[model samples]
Each structure stands twice: as C-alpha cells, then as structure tokens.
Target chain A: MKTCYNCNRLNKDNDRYCRYCGKAIRNNSYYTGLKIGIVLGTLGIIIMLILYAIMYL
Target chain B: MKCIKCGAELEDVDNFCPECGELTAKGHRFFHDPSNLDILNNGKAVKLKKKFNAIISIFSLSVIIFALLMIFTGQNLMTPFGVIQKKINYYRYGYNTSLIKTNNKYNFKVNNYDEAIEFIKKDFSNQLYTCNQNKELTMLEYELESDYEIPSVVFCDMSLEEAHKIKDVIVRMYALFPNIKGNLTNITITNSKTGSDYVAYFQPAYQFVNVNKDIKENNKVNKTQILLNSYYFLNDNILSQDINEVLNNYYVEDATFESTIAHELGHYISFVAFLREKGVSNITLVTKDNEEEIKSLINEFENGEYLKNILEQALNNYNLKYNENLNLQSFAETISKYAGVKDKNGNLLYSETIAEAIHDYYLHNENAKKSSYEIVMVLKSKLKEVF
Candidate 1:
C-alpha cells in the first residue's frame, strides 16, 4: 500500500497514481529520477567549484 | 633613320648614314618599322596618341579612386616602421630597430638559468589546471583551448639549453621595462593549444589567486604571470640566434619567441596601466587592509565601467575613422585578424585587441596600426603617464 501526499489517500502499492486524488505515488521510477537529479546536481556543483578554484587558486 | 650631323646614303632601317653621314628625312622615324608607314599615312598615329592618352587617363582615375578608398578605409600610406623611421631617423644608424633587443642588459631577479627553473617550479605547478585537451604535442603536447575562465597552465620539461633561451628572453623582457621590477613573474612554458587565443598571454594577479579571502597569511604581492607555448622553442621554428632579429623580424607563418613574449608583456603593461588608472598603488601588496577594496576593484575593472569605457572610446574612434557603423567585434576584426578573439557572448575581447595593437606598434606593422591608431594612442598615453 502507498499513500498519496497530495490527497492523503491510500492506494495499492503497484498503482502509479492515487485512485481518489489522481496524484502520483512515489515509485521506483520516481526514486530513480530523484537519484539522477541529485547526482547531476551534485556533479554540476562540483564542476563549478573546481572551475572556481582553478580560476582563483 | 640617319644622323643629323653626318648622314650620306641611309637605309630605311638605319639610324646613321652609311656613307657621308648626312641627315635623311626617312630617318625621322628612328626605330619604327618601314612597313608601319601605312598606319602613319592613314592618320592612325594621332589616333594612337589619343588611345594612349585615354589609357593614361583611365589609369590615373583608377589610381585616384584606389587612393580615396584606402584613405576612407583607414589604410595609411605610412606603416608604423615608416612613421618611426621618419621620427627617429632610424634608417641612418643601420642598427637593429627592435626596442627591446637594443636596450636589453641581461638583468634578472633570478641569478642563473637553473635558478629561474627552480623559481618557476616553486611558484607554479606542473599540473595543467584548465588545459583539458589530449592532443599529442610535438615536443610537449598541449590540448586545452579554454578562454580566461580557467587558468590554462602548461608545465613543459625544459632542457638546460631551452631554459637558457627562456632565461635570455626573460632578461631582455625585464630590461625592456625596468619600472616593472616586481610586476612580471611566474613565466611557465606551456604547450596549451591556442585556437582563438594568442599563443602567449599575460594573466593578471586576481586570476592566479583568490583575492576575496581574509588576508591573514597570503599577503604576498602577486604579479602577472606570463604563459608561453613551447612550440616557439622548437628547433625548426627558430628564426635566428640573435634576439634582436627574433624581436624585430615579422614572419608570415610562425610567431617568433621574442615577439610573442613582447606581446604578452604588452598585456602586462596595459593591465598595469589600468591598475594605475583606477588609483591602485604598490600593486604587489595584498594586505587585509585593502583586500576587499582590491577584490571589488578587480571585479569592476574586469566586468564593470572601466572596461566599458575603453571599448566605447575605441569603437567610437574606429567607426568615425572608417565611416561605418560597426560593433566591437567587427571593429576588432577590422583592426587586425588576431585582435578579433571573441568573448563568451561573441563580443570581441578589448584587451586582446589592445595587446595586438601594442604588438603592431612594437613591430611597426603599418596596416594594423592605421586602423588601430586610436587604441595605440591610448596605449602610448598609458605607457607614458602610468609607467
């Protein structure tokens, strides 16, 4: 079972969206996207920092 | 044709008499073929004169138009060398015309070639920071072509011979401007590929170190670092053993080591001039007292009003002279091919243009100086007033 944060409704674990609210339920794909986003964001920040250090070291 | 003084019996082809040397009427057409007499008889001689006159007139008119175009296009009749030759009567001396070479006294802060190498190793690292390219260099390979955003350093392994040559260059460069006693340092041999960038560059102090830090310990005065590509030091590329020849002579194919150094030094001089203009004194000092002020000033100078004013003035002068409405990039291209290096937004870098102008001013390349006169004048003023 999963809970939709938007509508506070309970749903089946396999369902991608809440039955009552039509809100997206946190799933494998969502976690994968979040992971990728965080990874990319962290990489971006690190690259920027390296550039800054190189320019003004 | 027969001689006037002594003609007797003369053939139609003869310029002098064969017998008594008496004048002959037929000899009046001295070298003209006898078969061409029909044209003269038909009044074509006068027509030929008219044709000749028309040709001359057309040529004259074309010349006048070309001269006008050259003038309007900011092409001066005199080159930088010609101008200086006229001013100083340089041609009379038969001496080397290079300003740096003729004045070189072999003075350096570092004692010897080995010492210079040691000093450089201590000051800068062998690790290239921004040069990310993987191109296989000839002697020492360099691949990165990034702009000013990253400090693209190249640390080439130098033989004692190469170090000696570089030491000679450094000594002469310093000798050229004694006033910049502590301003120029950290010269590193680089193989960093320069695509749109010049082969050599003068990086200012702020670019080398973090000026925004709290000045607790790193108060050492930072000087501009000169990065030169090792490609110029290759044996096949060397023009002459004489530094004078290296500095003054302009080659169409390759950049001479001395001239490239001069060009970077020109950048240093220009930067120093900028600092002086902004009222910064003792350019070496970076104490906690003036840290924030220095940081803001550098930021402002790089991206603020100071740079804007220079570009504005240069563009106005260029447009007015050429009678064309051109933006900074186009104007920079008009001045010199090398001067047209663009920034991230595609606008031309004013400092590169100025450095090229200063290079031409030193080399006496007239065509570049003709269009870059205004900026050259500003550089001259800076050299005079600031240095």
Candidate 2:
C-alpha cells in the first residue's frame, strides 16, 4: 500500500496518481495526457479501420 | 516563372534569358546564399532589392572561409582565422558578436550546477506557496494531463536512467532548477544570451545546460559518468514508461512540452535542504561507488542541533500542503506539463520545465538566480503540491 508522504493518506501502491490527494504516488512529473491523446486516438483509428475493412471486404 | 539560363521561362528557349542575359538561377537570390538579405522582408516585395548583399553575406560566408582555410593552409589556421574575424567584428561594432563554441567553463565556475539550483529551491521553500489551478485558474488545470507520486523526496536524488530489455540509455546532458508552487518569481529568465561561462546567463549564478549535442561519432571511447548523484536509477523496470517519454518531450521547444532538469533538481535541492534541516552537513549523497565517502559524511551528521527542528517543520509543512491537495490539484495541473517527468521506477525524462525556465533566466539574463526568492514564491504556489 502507498501512503501520502504528507497526510499519511492510505492509497493503492499500484495507483500512479493519488485518489484523495490527487498527487503522484510514484513519479510526480508525469505528463497528464498529451501523448496519451495521440496513442489512444491512433489506436481508435486503427481499430475502426480494421472493423470497416472487415465489414466491407 | 521563366528560367533565364535556359530561356525556357517555358518558351522552347534554351541557355538564353527571356528578358535579360543573366542566367535564371544566377539572377535569383534563392539560388544563392540568402545571408544578409532580409529574405522575409524581401519576400513581401516582388522585386528583389540589391544584386549583392554585402553585410550579411560577409557574416554568413566567412564561416566557410576558416573551414576552407584549414583544408588549404593544411594546418590549424581555423583558430587564428577565427581570432582575426572576431577582432574585426569587435573593431567594427566595438562588440564581439561571434558565438562562443563549446565552453566547458560553467561546470567548473559554478561549482557543480547545484549551488545555482539550491539558491532557488531553498527560497521557494521559504515562501507561502499557493496551488494555482483554482476557480479562475481553470485553464492551467486543463494542462495537467497526468502525474505520478514519489513516495518520498528521496527519489528526487536518483540518477535518471531509461532501461529497455536490451539497453540502458543515459542522457549525455541534463539541467536542474527549482520548482515553486506559484508562478510568481522575482527572477526573470529570458531569451537573451549574455555571460562568460557559456551559452548565456540571465544572472550571475544561474545558467541553462542547453542540450549537449556534442557526441563523438568515433569508436574512440570518450566517457563521462553521470555520477550516481542523479535519481534516474532508483527502480529497475518498475516505473511508468509514459513519464520517461514525457521527459523527452520537454526537450521539444515551444511545443507546449514544459520541462526543465532544474525543476526535478529543485526537488532534490529541496531534499538536500530538507536533509540540511535535519542538521545534515557535508553529507553529500553519492552513488554506490562513492558509498564509503558518503557514508562517512552521513555519519558526521548523525545528531545535530537542527535535525529535529528540520523534521518537525518539514513534516508539518508537508501535511498542511497535502490537506490542500484537491484545491492544489488545479495548480499542479497547470505546472505539471512544464515539469521534468519521471517514471514510477525513478527514470527521469527530458528536461525539467522549471529548470529550463530558470535556465533561460540564467543563460540570458544578468541577475541569474539573484532574485530566487520571488521566483520561489511564484513557482512554489504553482507546484508546492505536485510532488
């Protein structure tokens, strides 16, 4: 289990960011969602293309 | 639209100018070096100005002079030729405008780059920092894509390393700076380059360790160890890889990738200060290789006058700050993007944003880390809670 260094708030160890405090649990300087957007968007496009190809072909 | 050299501005003509005898490519400045010619300004005007631009061409073309000089002169004439040109520029403008190439002096003059960083980190801690992503701060809040937490500030002192299944990558160059909680620093970092040690310093002590692009391409082993003084090697394959990439993104200029090595180093500076608060002195944290020496230093600080007070103050301050995390979340969100990212495993990525911010100040300004107190106040309010 992870705990807030400041408040002693118990948190899940696997959780990257905190739930109650919202601070980072392991790495504090992670980018929020810049590339996350690109990665997820790319995956979505690829999936949609595959589905479209299957339906049409 | 017509080629003069071939007279084919497209009319079945060859080797002849449509209107003038000048070769098509020869008449066009685009085909030639656009050195001192204000191409942008000239682009707006359809008609080209002067046939030969004297000033900028001299400035730009002379670079080739010394290179050719060495090849022909068959000696290290490039150095003397550079000196002569610099003197000419000085004589002409009463100032030297020639860029200094490869100055490794700052590393020696500033005393390991951390002192400049400490100046800001310590001051940032002394201020009443506020979390900025509040009600009016809605925009800054959106900037926070994500963040991970370090269990303790101790991770602040690890060596940044990115290890894949096959290889471990070490950054040849990195920066360090202080991250404040607010956006109101007294120190003003800028784009102007001025200073003696290197790139340019906004102030005396602070400087940005601009990415070192000096990679020797030969098999000649030129190695410089990034002493275990960094926090990149804490965990092995146990951290977030996303954080590592984000750190690299920070190196991207003006792309909304905010990062600075100093900001991450700021955390370490604060950690060092925190250690100092515990009455730790001369207790340098070295890598395992230097374990013996550092261990001796730590032993020296076993119990000092300020140790307990340091713990109390920091513990209390941390708790006070965490209580405000939710409200601080918005603030953390704004500055989070600018921060030098790290992975859950303690791998440092790219540059730390605050480090770069201050580095910009250090490189371009005269005051450098001079007014770190104000900078601390501004940064503290914006990032006191992020870590």
TM values, all candidates: 0.42, 0.20
lDDT of 1: 0.49
Per-residue alpha-carbon lDDT of model 2 for B1-387, expressed as tens digits? 565343334222212242333434333434355552342234311111221233234433544554464446333333443344445754764433332221222211122324434432333222212111122222211122111111101112122232111011101111223331221112211112331112111111122222132212211111111111111232233223343363444332322111233333343333334333344332221223433544443343332222223323333454465563322222222233443344456433222333443433433343433222223334344333443
Question: Rounded to one decimal, what is candidate 2's iRMSD?
Answer: 33.4
Which runs in model 2 stand beyond 4 Å of their true positions?
A: A1-57, B1-291, B295-334, B344-387
Best by TM-score: 1
TM-score of 2: 0.20
Off by over 4 Å in 1: A1-57, B1-182, B190-198, B206-214, B217-221, B231-257, B318-326, B365-367
lDDT (C-alpha, whole model) for all candidates: 0.49, 0.30
Fraction of true inter-chain Cα contacts (below 8 Å) kept per model?
0.00, 0.00
lDDT of 2 at B352: 38
User: What CAPRI grade goes to candidate 1?
Assistant: incorrect
